[model samples]
Target: MKIKNLALAVAALYAGSAYALEPFVIKEIRVEGVQRTEPGTVFNYLPVKVGDRLDDDKAAASVKALYATGFFKDVRLEAEDGVLIVAVDERPTIFQININGSKDFDKDQLKKALKDNGLAESLIFDRALLDQATQELKRQYYAKGKYSVDIKATVTPLERNRVAINFDISEGAVATISQINIVGNQAFKEGELLDLFSQTTGGWFSWITKDDQYSKQKLSADLEALRSFYLNRGYLEFNVDSTVVSISPDKKKIYITVNLSEGKRYTVTDIKVGGELLVPEDEVRKLIRIKEGDVFSRELVNESTQSISDRLGNDGYAFANVNAVPELDRDKQTVAFTFFIDPGRRVYVRNINITGNTKTRDEVVRREMRQIEGGWYNASKIRRSKERVDLLGYFEDVNVETPQVPDSPDQVDVNVSVKEKPTGNVMAGIGYARGTGISFQASISQSNIFGSGKYLALGLNTSKSSKLYSISYSDPYYTPDGVSRGFDLYYRKVDPTQLSLGQYNTAGVGSSMRVGLPISEFDTVNFSLGIDRSEITLLTGAPQNYIDFVSAFGSRYTTLPATASWVRDGRDSALYPTRGALRRVESLVALPGGDLRYYTLSAQNQWFYPLSKTFTFMLNAEAGYANGYGGRPLPFFKNLYAGGIGSVRGYGTGTLGLKDSNGDALGGNRKVVANAELLFPIPGLKGDKSARLSVFGDAGSVWGSGDKMSFGDLRYSAGFGLTWVSPVGPLKFSVAKPFNPKDNDKVERFQFQLGTLF
Candidate 1:
């Protein structure tokens, strides 16, 4: 073995020295042994041509440049009869590269990523490139829990100037959290300290959330959270000293240690106000809720300063500023706060400027603004205009700026800029239910019509059991003063599941007028009035069980109904709601001249709570009751039915209400529902805005007879769903399982919809 190795080493040395030769002048330049490389490429790198002179210095420079091209290994220049000849041997690259250890990033995707970074099959790989690739791979691994990883690249040369590369990766065991220790904490227990951090020890879902991954970024954020927690509770001098992370010898477990300094708590000694005040000092002081004898809370101090500023703002001092400075006495454990106020000259808006709205018209933005030019500065109105602009989903970013007029100290100009996004969508999809049975729908709509920020939608659906066509329109700034208005018209044909009964076709046209008024910065009240006339065609399949109820309660042919509704919307956004409450109270009454005369009253309340940065919980409840007073009974078109995306998830569409003997929905009079969800991003799919995934639990039921409402009949469903914001708008897919099932219930394990949310 020693003799063979020595012979190989000597051959390598000879090959290296064969290219080192004295330079000679050239009469002609010729390239030998060229295949993939162009002849011009060799001539471009040659130091001597047919008419040029050659020397050792130029030859050495030429060799360096040729080698830097990374395409050749042995480059030699020879001269004979004053003719220059260049001979070269190319380096073989790994024609195929295969990786073996990856669970977080898909193999195909990782290969593509590597190719983008200049690591590809059949390419000449160097030590520098390999080192960079290894570091990048480790970064991706650390993003998960595999903190310790090993990678080995094995290259095997193949025939025809090629090689095959195989990367054997040993993805070390995932590191799990063994324990978390917090020192120098007295006001809170150890359990409380652990609860403050998102990371935790091993749990049932730790593999999914992966909270065990210890990163410097996460630790820094946790330390800031601890600081805020203590500051809000009057620990004015609290500080975090240091943090230590320890890993086990086996590299499968980790421990965290946090060192904190809990200084003395302080009480309020005195409060003082300085600087100019647009409002009376005594009146501004009343807005500060913090008392002298109370504990010194950082939150309260900030709140008090903000309250004072708001009070001044409402009084026309739009540029008022307030800052709180605290003086601490270590001996007495007391802190004194001083609030400095600055109220700039009261300025009126000189001009309202609009920009950044590429598609939306200037009129649309102007109409939504509450602050008007040549009017006294109103901070509340300016804030309202910003909110109104944000509510228009056409923009991804909306901001307002107040630039002072050059010559006018008392006048300022307002500028509103918006970023536009795609607002048109097309939807072509199908759905199935016991009653609808393989229904297909096609819809098209433009939420920002003609760049005017108006909504217009048209939809059509056809199925074996029914057909529907509808057109709807909405104007958020209907009156040029931020009031909202909308209207809808539809014609639908409903055929019961039991063909032996009958079918009903209904045609209606409706128009509604709405007005919106802001009750506060984050709340608004909307009132609407609408009237519609419907013509009902009773066909042959209306179940025998529902015939009696329909004949007694529903109208015979045509009916006219009038409705009035009051709604309050306090949500942050319509598409991705984080925090809000929606309350609606509506009443529909049959006209005296219509075929049916009756009244129905309904009220619903929905509340959304943000559990964390990535999770939200929603609760909703509704009730409706109808009684015959005059004329005929209520029409079937106005009856309420529950199920599907906006109701219970485990059942078919409109199947939550009372059912006839043949299992056809008879509609309902009362309904109630509650839902909870935990939302997070999908692992390895970060930065993708097309879809959002969540886990949810649903519970609710509907009752026809008010007195029969019972918890025993309540249905329960738990599932996970994926919401995709596709070009055709939002599409939702859910796989749900029933927690409790009844004998006659049709519990669907999977349900999906095109555009709806409950």
Candidate 2:
């Protein structure tokens, strides 16, 4: 007890003496262990300068601030000869970052994204920031169906305040949909339910569209679509109780369970109308296709209301509202619907205003407006005007808005805005084909020069087999009433192969005038007249077949062709077609002053349909025939050959018809062709619109000496093709295999071709 008392007394005395001692006066401050940091930086953080008293509290504060800079791992202060020394160990930054498990995002993209968020390589590592980054990456992966992915980060410190980081990742197998079970769906089978989902099991074209790439976003959208589908089909009380997604232990397979409560099907028991109407009630009711007893279809109800509103607008009530309300009857399992119509103040358009068209002339845009002052408003015409503006191809987006005039109930103003897009193109390129060898082409075109919405083009093409030069100009609104006018002038020269017709050469100049009329929003009809004259040259090594064709035809060819074309273009864009149709019928007659005379008629049609979001179907058919009417046979230069990239595909160019003595096929005067294509995006080029790949099947026949072309003589081919809408123009290359080959066929089984702007 006595020794413990003596020890406590001694400790107290030592503490008191230490506190009573005077504070150290700093003579000089010294810093060490810093290679990049300047001496001034360390001195600036030191509160006690030379000849100042250094206290323990000030020393502690300086150390804390230095550590907070995130540049040092260890900091210390020592006093010697009244001088203070501060030492620091700098923290190393992460120099290299590696992530091991990622399937949804590109590694480089992720790295860049992280860098933008202050997690770049060579930046000092922070445990808290890394945790947040990991969570963010995981969330993104979950959105793309990598819910089971694991990320491991390994960091190594290098010399010079640098560290190397490696993220060892185990991106587990993707969870594919194995089954989707929907409960309480008695009206539709499970297969039908599955069909409604964009994500599905593998199909024959699974490799193309990749519909099996399961994603949570897609699943959520599909669920919403299912809900809408039911509600729109008279299932008013339908509800999805829960959606449970289950994954296997290996994470390779997934199962979805949807619990649904499908309430009783309801029938419309009553219909009520309300609100003021400018048009007669009978007229408005006539527009509603739905009857009282018809099944309660949300689509029909909404469509009927829209029709009523549109009808009111046609009656000069531009600002009108028509809405459908449903009242439920629990006992009868029926619902009564009421369409409330409000034909708001019948206002006149005092003035039509146009804005946002800096480059386009005001008159040019105003002329396209369907609504005009001193005229009754027409909703249909206004919508048509919007479509016309869109079809001009000069604007990225066009919008029309009606802003009401304050205190002027009977007057309103309309504003139209347009966003301009690049509408001019200049292209020059070189290409090669089996028959043409190598060809060069150059073209310059402007769809909307100076925002006038007119089209002008000048082009030149030269190859071993042919040469062409052309100039064209078109005005969509030639007279400001939307009537289209165009004219084209062209010159072309064609030289036949030595094996065909004694190496014949033909040069022709032609001119055409065209007039177009809009049949509907989606259809246009065009009429044209063309006159052409040709001079023929017979070179050395002339074949007997060529001599026969030339003797039957005239030496100086002169013809007049009349053409009528119908185009139903519903495609979103002209350059890249999602769906549309192009059809034409043309007839040519040889002039009386020409060396040879004949009357020929031809018809062609093509249709495109989108099979899915990423798949499309294209169908084409054409037929042409000519017979001597006033003079000899049709000119050889005008003959059609059905084999190549643009034709039968499996055979060489101009090799599908009749063969001559030298086994070379003679071009045909009568031709028939049918083709179908199933198009899909190349796997890695999904968002790339310039290049596309597709599979096609072609079948066609040609007749030279025969009176009538027979389908039995038709040749068939199947192939895969690549289409590139390059800056220079469209290029088509194909590799084909013939399905049927005759004994005397000299056409190669495989062929390649590149076609420029038509």
Candidate 3:
């Protein structure tokens, strides 16, 4: 009787065994209705196996386990002839996903979004995921201010139990901020406060700035901006209580209302220093910008703390902490500030870790670093190191981080990570101009070849008037002291008669070797010497002066030329300089060995002053003088010419110089050019360097040997120019009105070039 009870208890322990079924020992198990899933997979999920005793409990458990796998839509089990048969209907797989009418987002991006939301191709189809994907797409568009977006998802059954999903979308118009109001009373006027916000109601410039568009992100930023504005002006207790946003019934107009409290303005009553002043008290006092009796400013306080911290960091205190603890007296509307400084352990750099230079040589990058390993950590050196690496042009981005060494309080590691960019360019272009017709140019240049940081360039250009071929090579780090070496070879042919410039043509071949010495962080002095050989050919209608010059010096001659130049560039960016200055002073002389013994001196200075984040004022001036030496006249071809787009924009190319008897421009030995411009960002595209618009005024001219240099002789013009860094190349177009022009001057009201300017 006890053995019988044990058997019955074991059966009772089996779950869901109340529905009685005959017990049987399974000899084999067969899976059915599993076309996609393998038989073994069904068996793995099955609770009962071959040679196992089966009953109603086991059968129910097997069906539950198979259903939990979610791979099957229907599951069943049957016992026949002592063999267990498992059945399952596999869910349909997603074969393809199609999205149409998606102009704002890329198709791949949409697909990826769906995949991240648990819906994509080649996955089990779920009707819930289709709705989820639709919502996700709508949410993305809504963030961009598109509130009326409509999405229709369709699931089409395919062969082999697969399904295809297609999302037909109708993205609607952006919801514009029709009105914005500040509900709470404020010390500042509404107009003044609105100016600080990134969002705004409709205005003349709204189309360009898109500030009228309502976005949650922009609203949050505006709130933060409002908070900062008040805090910067002594509103110590300013708070943004609430922000209310609403959209019209049509989903095209949005209104924003911000409620805020304007607290009492505070004035600085006293300033003091405390806590481990490693430097002299007087020195620390000098760093504080806030003063007693002045309006309290959080920005000023932050600056004072940062200044103190940096001062300590200069002395190897890499972990220095500086904080401005303020005490407020609401009754008197006064605040007192105490700058507390903590000069942590004087740490040194234990290791210099460099990464992300997968293709570039490590030594190539290490050479540009100014911060040294195993040395006292100097913040200035670390900053300079980052700047040096950033200016290499080999990397798209450079980042430096100094992290403390593990388990070492006085040791740190300087990590320099770089993102390499393609340093080579292969460009081929065809251009047209009235002066130079049907021009073709091709160039292959690499600034970092084979990751060696060597420079090489080969170029070929031909026009109706001339043909040029050149090759140049340079090693920027030829010596440890930051000296650069380079060589250039070029062959050229000119037929000025082709463009009616002159009835003479000359072909030349020249080679030069140059060395650049870095005198300072932002300055370099370069010296080069070259030899040139040219043969002049006087055409049938050659000018008398040209014939006379050829007769005097002979047709064929060789000259050794030497040049020296000092360059200083302090601009914030090379491509789009908004602040700082660029200055170059160059002198070139044809030595005694040259057929033409002459010397030329030139100076150019360009100053870019930033007026605002998106506007700049630029001033440029250039002057050059050339004269004969050793009783040999300066070669006519070497004479300076000014005009056209790069000089006086309204005048024709090379037309600002003296005119010969044949009505062709005769370049002179002296030149002067000046330009003033108001530069600003392209509408709707702030901070985009690829394109810019500028209004400019220009004045320049050239003087012959017999003519005297005078400002009165300079050509003057004013115009607007557009510069676009297009895929093919940089394109510059300008339309100018000449302020003053002589009747003989060729007036080119519009000019454009599809290549780099310099």
Candidate 4:
């Protein structure tokens, strides 16, 4: 026999004199010392079964395997008269895991973490596992900057081989960044560079923003931001040498230091394209933003590469590669660039998949996709698909990915993932607005009904002075070619005495049919035709013009109105826009069949430009003109008005218009409004883009039909405001001071708009 075999035989036979086994034929197997584990389970783990010859090797293997099950803390095998005996000292099962005195994290969350680490209730207990769970708890607290947190784990055995674990935690105060220093920066002031960082030392807003909290992840992001700041400004060789983070003795204060190397700025001396120019050289060359003699910017260089790749993608090359190689002349601080392009396999989309829409139908999303399955991939189309989905406003986020198909070089799949938002509401709310006063509204609407992407609404709005009821519906894909059709039915009653626009009451009931046609990706034209019946009631302070109109046209009149509108909305966000311009032009005409004859034309232009990483500058302008035509007058109730909430904020609602002898505002036929605002994130709400602050200047006016148009007549005001795209709806609040106010002009210092979907 081999020495190893002999040793095993000796060890197995001499293990226990009371129950020793040599080479024996086992008649039966019995398991002992198992309180919870089944006898069958013990037999299942045995390497040798009944009627099998049991040897030293088999006995040793059986014992090793039984111990490996982890159900037993100890396992021993014995044989008596050809019967194998399996004895095990079972490990106690964990009955419960308790975490106490943990305010920073929830007990359930900690338990889940332990479970993920293979330590949880009903699992076999081991001191090693307890140590593991303790370490995991400490790691979690440390991640939250709780460097002084202490965790003590205790295990208590119970009946039936069960145990309970308790983790007593002492989570100390979170370490806060007391100071942040940037070294070796010469191109910009220290404050300027620091302004680019998302992390900061303790400041007025630190409590909410948590910028003072020490985070390795945030530091890494800040370093990347610094790198981008230099690289975009022509410091092509800029780098972060090192970063040091220190905690005070009490582990409550953290100090951070960033060392940087700002290399000399370089200018582009020459730019050229090389390699596999599937497209025309001129076309690719024109895609580069960095021209000869221009300062070298890594951003522009990367843009050039992406553009080249996209241009190739337009021709069905899904995996195009564009490499920008630079030759540097250190003495002259200039760089010569060459872009090498490789148009890879022209792959086709194998399939299109949509996910994350619980209510929206798959077909609705599929219809919005510009990139179709089984077609050659187009980067522009894929991007457009994402934008179109976002424009639906049915989702909070949209992500599109094209993953290469396994083992298929020429195939890829388009995966569209969306995070849906609430697109339906059955809500009632009360709100106060500067112009509309206290208002009550109840609405039932579904913008994506059953995920079919149709819009339907029934609404009622009531105020002390006015009331409105409306029903509207729209099918955006009415014609399948992206044409939209909708109709509105509404009844409204208004009394202007309380509103201060004029001392009169007017009621109107109308219905309109609207049709929209998409002219391009970002532009749409809509036309609506409607018929309305209007009644006017002149009060004690009614204007002369209103009395005259009521007397000439009678108290009640019927009119047919037709409107046309064209809009190009290019803003990145419909709410809190930071970039792009929105242009809208509309015209309305009272048809020849109506009791009144007049025409109006209006234009609005708005631009949002990012001034810096932290600020956005927005400029908006609007103007309108209306006049009587064909020997008829523009209706008094239809006159254009400007001032207050949306116009000159410090001025009373519609009070910038001309005033009559009765001291009532008589709205005009011509109107103009202009606004300039600097928008920034609220101090402590940097991470929450749904809310923001803005300082704005507003100028507006309304000229009577007999008055001349002049920019000097525009009422001007300046103020700060808060805008929040809250979960319930959009809310805006403003406080303003008029720069100049005429003696008779009504001035209001504050204004707001808050309503459900108002």
Which 10-residue span in candidate 1 carries the lowest summed lDDT?
A: 1-10
The regions of model 4 sitting more than 4 angstroms off are 1-26, 51-60, 356-358, 419-422, 756-758
TM-score of each: 0.64, 0.66, 0.83, 0.94
- Of the two candidates 3 and 4, the one with more favorable lDDT, higher being better, is 4
What is candidate 3's lDDT per residue for 218-260, written digit by digit as tens?
8898899888889889999999999889889989899889999
CA shift of 462, model 2, Å: 3.4
Better of 1 and 3 by TM-score: 3
Per-prediction count of colliding residue pairs? 9, 8, 1, 0
| Candidate 3 residue-wise lDDT at 406 | 87
Top candidate when judged by TM-score against the true structure: 4
lDDT of 2: 0.75
Model 2 over residues 1-758: C-alpha lDDT tens digits? 00111111223434453322245777778888887778888777666688777654555556666777777777766666766777777777777888766666899977876676568876777766677776777666665556688877667868887877776667765666787788878998888887778777667656565567677788898888888788778888889999898888877777888899888888888887877866677877788877888777777888899899888877778889888888999789899877888888787777777777878777777777778876666677778777777766778999977777789887777777888878898878887676677889898999877778789999999888788999999998887667899999999988767324225788999999999987766677888888888888765555665677767664676777666766665656566666877777766666566456676778888888999767889999999887666546665566777777788887777777776665666677888999999988776455567777889999998898564667788999898988888655567788788988898765565565565633
Positional deviation of 76 in candidate 4, in angstroms? 1.7
Sort by lDDT, best first: 4, 3, 2, 1
lDDT of 4 by residue, 1-758 (tens): 11122223335444643234357677888887889999999888778889999775676677677777888877766667777777778999999988899998888899999998889998989888789878888889878889999898888988888998988888999998888899999989999998777878778888777887888888899899899889888898999999999999999999989999999999999998899889999998899988999988888999989998998897789899999999999889999999999998899999999999999999889888999888899999999999888889999999999999999999999999999999998988887777667889899999998889999999999986689999999999898778999999999999876767787888999999999999898899999999999888888867677788888879887878899999999999887688999999999998888788888999999999999767999999999989889898988777888887777798888888678886668888999999999999998677688899999999999998788888778789999998887766678889999998888899988888886433
- The model with the greater lDDT, 1 or 3, is 3
Please report the candidate that would top lDDT against the real structure.
4
